[model samples]
Target: MNFILYAVPFFVVLIVLELIVDRWRGVSNYRLADAINSLSTGVLSTTTGLLTKGVGLVTYAFALKHLAVIELSAESAWVWVFAFVLYDLCYYWLHRMGHERNILWAAHSVHHQSEDYNLSTALRQTSTGFLLSWIFYLPMAVLGVPLLVFVSVAALNLLYQFWVHTRHIPKLGWFEWFFVTPSNHRAHHAQNALYMDRNYGGVFIVWDRLFGTYQEEDDNDPAIFGVTTPLASWNPLWANMQFYAQLWNDARRAESLWDKLRIWFMRTGWRPADVAAKYPMAKPDLSQFRKFEVPLDGRQQLYVALQFGVYVALGSYLMNLADSLPTAALVLGWGAVAFGLFAQGAALENRPWAFRLELLRLALNLPLVWLAPLAGLWPASAVAWVGLLSYSLFSVIGLYCCRNRITRLAS
Candidate 1:
């Protein structure tokens, strides 16, 4: 069972509640573009997970079959409890390595790209994490934890982390010492020197405390969210690929083959001496830091918001039907969704070409409405066709209206 799917409505509810709290407190923690960009990465991650999750599942299953020392029953309550805690311990190392190593950070940095830390940031996940993340939990499989237990505990651990991404909650007195909380987790998200790589635990704070990575949240030195190397664009596709692209370029530029091969495994931010000398990258001064922003008029904002809403609905539909859909349909659906998100991000960034991109996306959907069903995504129905056609028609009209605003902003 996909527990995250069932929890989507609750996540929406909590985000809305956080917005209300933001209003009541008269502090703005959420930006429309930043939040939308964060969610775009999340939606992309979920859609990508449909195709890639089998990597982890298959490998873990193979490990359990070949390497298990004992058979653990999923029916035992103690097994569930033990698996939950143990899964978090494995997560601690994975989370820590994701920060410490270049290759892992290339995948994990998606979650840290948001300049504003909010509930939406929690949803900003890595689409490529399945490639290596499964290795972290092989210990559980070898120790004989049932697959069902491992998956359930993993999901529960993730769900528990959603609420800790907020600034609204203060330090919970004694609870701060044991479990991961809003205060400590905020420190984890900070780019400040004091908080750079601290607080790596997912559920329990004890791992950090035990491993000497713990650092308390200080009132004097507040947290500044985002990475050392900022992801300035709102483009979801670029957000995922930015660091990897940097690494690839650095590798290509290095004079030594060993530097090329080992660059990926080196500590985060480490660069070859030759590459570092030729192409110097400067870290921003935190004291003079400013969040990335692109101005949009009211019409542009509404147009992007409406378009994003349509994709969110489409994304939810894709998630629900993904398992039953054929490979051709999944590929087509994934491509359309991915393109739609990129166009939305372009729109948010006020790119001059955004209007054409959106218009093209809408025009393509006119055929996709008919083609999607034929490709085995859904059964053909008049309602699906008409609903999609109407959506495209109105969206084209909206995109046409926003052309001037996008042009003015881009210029």
Candidate 2:
């Protein structure tokens, strides 16, 4: 069972609840643009996972089949408990290494790009983590933990970590010592010199405590969220690509072949001596750290919000149909989702190109609906066609209506 599928509705409810709580408590933890971008990257990551997850499964199966040192029965409760702990240990290292290595950070940095730390930030995950994350879990397969057991524990570990992303939760004295509570995880998310790269455990804080990576939440030094180098944009696609682009540019500028080759695997944020001297990167002043924001009229914000809601609906439908859809259909669906997110990101940023791209997206949906049934990609239903056409038409009309609002905001 895909536990995340069942958890989606709960995730949505909790996010909405958090927003309401933010209002009731007079604390500002959720920002509209930032939350939308976080969820957009999350949706993109899920869509990408439909294609990439097989790599992890296949590799794990291979390791189990060829290299098992001992056979373990999945029916035992003790085995489940042991596997759960072992998985977190592996996750700790995988997460720690994700922060330590340059190429790995390129993938992991998406989760940290959001300046606001809230429940929405929890969902902002990396689509590219499939590149190397599976390598960390091979030990479980070698120990002969059944695939089902491994998957179940992995889901549990992930679910356990979700609630720790919030700011509303304060430190729990005894509980904080054993588990990765919000306080500890918030410290992990901080860009502060004291907390950066600390607390890598997923569910248990013991690994961090034992390994000397744990840092307590300090009253004097409050947690400041986000990466040292700010993402500085609202584009979800760019959020994923930005770090890789930086690494690529640094590698291209390096004078030596060795520098170019090792730049990717070197410690996170390391630059070649020559590249550092000539093409120096400016560090943000910590005292003056500010969250990224853009001014927009009410209609522009509403339009983006409504469209993102539609994208979420579409994404849920795609995830439901993922296993049954043909590769071509999945590709088309993913392209549409990616384009929608890109357009939404652009619109949020008030980019001039957004309107044209959104217009193109609206126009393209007509043909997609008209031919979806012909290609047998969509179920042949009058209501489905009407729904698609209605959404497309309504979106175009909304964009047309919002033009003046966008112009005024831009002015």
Question: How high is the CA lDDT of each candidate model?
Answer: 0.93, 0.91
Candidate 2 local lDDT, 299-410, one digit each (tens): 9899999999988887887789888888777777788889889999999998878889889989888888876766556888989888988988888888888996666766
* Residue clash pairs of candidate 1: none
Write down the TM-score for model 2.
Answer: 0.97
Error of 2 at 354 (Å): 1.1
- Clashing residue pairs in candidate 2, if any? none
Off by over 4 Å in 1: 404-411
**Predicted candidate 1 versus true structure: per-residue lDDT over 1-411, tens digit per residue:** 999999999999999999999999999999999999999999999988888888999899999999999889999999999899999999999999999999999999999999999999999998888989999999999989998898889999999999999999999999999999999999999999999999999999999999999999999999999999999999999999999999999999999999999999999999999999999999999999999999888898898888888778878988999888898887777888899999999989988787778788888987898788789987899998988899888887777777766568769
Stretches of candidate 2 off by over 4 Å are: 374-376, 408-411
Candidate 2 achieves a global lDDT of 0.91
Compare the candidates by lDDT and give the number of the best one: 1
Q: What CA RMSD would you report for each candidate?
A: 1.4, 1.3
